[model samples]
Target: MGIVLNQSLKNTVITYLGFGIGAINTLYLYPVFLGATYYAVTNYILSAANVIMPLFAIGMQNTLVKFYSQCKTEEERGRFLSFTVLFPFLLCIPIGIIGLFFFDDLVYFVSKKNPVVQTFIWLIPFTGLCMAYFEIFYAWARVHMHSVFGNFIKEVGLRLFSLFAIVGVYFNWISIVDFVYVTSGIYFLALIVTMLYAFKIKRPNFQFYIPANVKDILEYTFYIILSGSVANLLLDGDKLMLNQYLVIENIAYYSVATYIALVISVPSRAMHQIVYPITAKLMHENKYEELNALYKKTSINLQIVGGFVMLCIFVNISQLYEIVPKEYSGGIIVVFMIGLSKYFDLILGNNNAIIFNSKYYRTVLFLGLFLVLITIVLNRIFIPLYGIMGCAFATLLSITLYSLAKLLFVVKRMHLYPFTKETVTSLIVTAVLFLAFYFWEFPLYPLIGIALKSIILTAVYLYVNYKLVISKEINDIIDKMLLKFKLRS
Candidate 1:
């Protein structure tokens, strides 16, 4: 937990800063500068790329983290890493050739309903390739226990680039059309920087020979690719589906809600980047007792922190939306549904990391495929009926069902659960705050009202949780910080 806390805190700060910048871009700059149609084009292109990235990387990122810790020698580990790097080309080369031949047909099918996306169809595979290599390189860093810099690059550096590019649009230095190209370049830039950093951390010693455990390694990567694909589709699939069923501008509306909801999940995302390898190592060492302890601590701590984020979002949502354009106001319910879904996923802790790194990952992979099917079906039924709110509903249902299945699998398979008295207390406190703040708002300006309301809500929420000692881990950290403050004073 020491290393987890140390790195998790740093990663959390970096991710939050990234999301802060992203909020400005999504809510203000993209809408104001690019307009809804172009904003939708940009969002759709990225979503399509992420959907394809799993196929491009062939799940080698997960393969690297799971196998690196199990290898016995430098040569053994190096050979394994070399295979992860080389094997993706086996998958990607075919994918690229298909894209080259069916480019027009694929674009026609995808953009049949909304044609704006046709112009940027090529960007999807190009950006997906960039994202695929970026994850592989970042996984390279994670195996060496140097995830902070990679996380910072992935989280902050990319968003900063987007900030500058969108600002260029604002200043008329770049047109919206050119900014699309710039977005693809930003992803490539981040990948190059991260690849260099990974080389500096642990330079790859490329070997032509395949590892002896190639069969098992290939099996795991195969299942992991589907599981990874399912996870990403849940994150981005709704936006893509919306592109098919609705006008381009509607994606802009739904994307804003989804972006706000995703901010609640950033803590989990940041923590997982470093924790995945550690969890894999624990599994390799068969450290069940320590593993169980880590599981519970992460669940409770994330629940506490994730609850705080949701509180700030829901309580301040009205004021927050007041400042954004009125067209986006309809997504208030969208934010709530998606935010709760992500919070539910957060409370499950490192369950995904545990399952994906464990032997039972193949089982979860099939379950994930089923969940993805269900998500698409739900979106199909709901989106046509309810529009943007329907997309939110489909996502919430998918993540909720997927999360419960993962939680039960971990509990049954490992005989370990992440809930305790603290979990219940956190839920009670969160629910009470949600109720109390639902009707409360200030007569002050929107910005001042949001600040004041957030301050009051967070102060009270912290005081209650601390007094209850809902999580000894969280309380101890808070106590240590307070003691340091007192000592300095």
Candidate 2:
């Protein structure tokens, strides 16, 4: 718990800092600097990049993480690392060749409905290539057990670059076309810097050698590539599909709301870095008692933390939207819908880590593809009818369904549940707080009103949760933070 807590705290702070910078860019700067259409284009490009990279990289990042520790020597590790660095080229070259032959068809498909996407459509793969390499190098660093610097580069450095670029736009020093190109270049810059650092941490000893377990590695990477693609599609396919059916500006509207909602999942994401390995260790040891305890604690603690975020966002959603451009303000529904989905996924704890680490992970191949299929089907069916709200609905539905299946699988196989008495308490308290504060708004400016409501919400929420002990772990964390503050003072 000590190591987990320390790293989780550091990650939480860094993640929030990144999100803070992103919030500035998404909610404030992009809205003002790029406006609705260009802003939508920016987000669209990135979302597409995320979806495309898994295919290009062929899941080498996850493969690296899985097999790197199994090696018994530096030579074995070096060969494995070298293979991960080089294997992606096999798939990448094919993708490039295909894109070359089908460029017009690809461009036509993307921009047939929304022509703005046509101009920067090719940037998607370029950005995807850069992002894929960034993750590869980031994994390179992580294999050396050095993730903090890479996390900073991923979470904070990239956003900081975007921030400066936005100011360039605001000052008319950067045209929209140039901005798009430079933004893609920023992703490549992150890849270059992170790759350099990865080498600095532990340089990959280049060998024109493939590991003996090339078959196993390829098998795992293939499964991972498909599963990873499905996951990313569920996350970003809405934006991609929206480009086909709706106006490009709608992506901007949806992106802002989705970004705000994404804040709810930060706690779960922060904890995942350390928790995944711990879960794997416990499972390997067949220690059900400890694993169950950790599962319940993480679920309840995430619930308490994620619920607080959801409460603040929902309670002050109206005021939050007030600060955004009026043209983009219609996505309030998207926020709640997507926010709830992310919250549900969070409260399931590390269900994913448990499943992925277990022998039953093969089931994910079927389940993952099903989820992706349904997501795309739903988006295709609904987006034209309900527009951005439809996309939100699709996301919420698919994610909740996916979470439920994971929960059921873990319980049926492992005979443990993530819920305890604290789960009920945390949920009840969250519901009450949301209902109580949602309709009660201050009669003042939006920003001030949001501040006032948030402060009140946090105080009362904390007091009640602490009294009920819905999550002693979170309370312990708060206590430690306060103690450190006092000691420093």
Pairs of colliding residues, candidate 2:
none
User: How does model 1 fare in lDDT?
Assistant: 0.88
Local error of candidate 1 at residue 236 (angstroms):
0.6
**Poorest 10 consecutive residues of model 1 by lDDT?**
266-275
The TM-score values for the models, in the order shown, are 0.89, 0.94
**Candidate 2 per-residue lDDT over residues 1-489, each given as its tens digit:** 575466567767888899899888889888888888888898899999999989888899989998999999988988888888887877688879989999999989999988888888889989998999899989998778777788898899999999999888878898877788889999999999999999998866788677888899889988998888987888788899999899899999999999999989877777787799899999999999999999998899888888998999999999898888888878999999999999999998888899988888988768988998889899999998999999999999988998899899889888989999888878889998888999879989998999999999999998899778788887787778879889533
List per-prediction Cα lDDT, in the order shown: 0.88, 0.88
- Stretches of candidate 1 exceeding 4 Å from the true structure: 1-10, 68-83, 144-146, 199-209, 269-296, 487-489
Tens digits of per-residue lDDT, candidate 1, 1-489, equal: 687678777888887887888888888888888888888899999998999899999999988998888899988988887888888877688878888898878889899999878888889989999999999999999888888898898888988899999989989999999999999999999999999999998877887668888898888788878877987898899999998888888999888888888889877876686678888999899998989988898899899999999999998898888877888898999999999999999998888889977888778889989998999999999999999999999989988998999898888889989898888889999998999997889999999999998999989998899899888878888889989889433
Model 2 ranges off by over 4 Å: 1-9, 475-489
Error of 2 at 43 (Å): 1.1
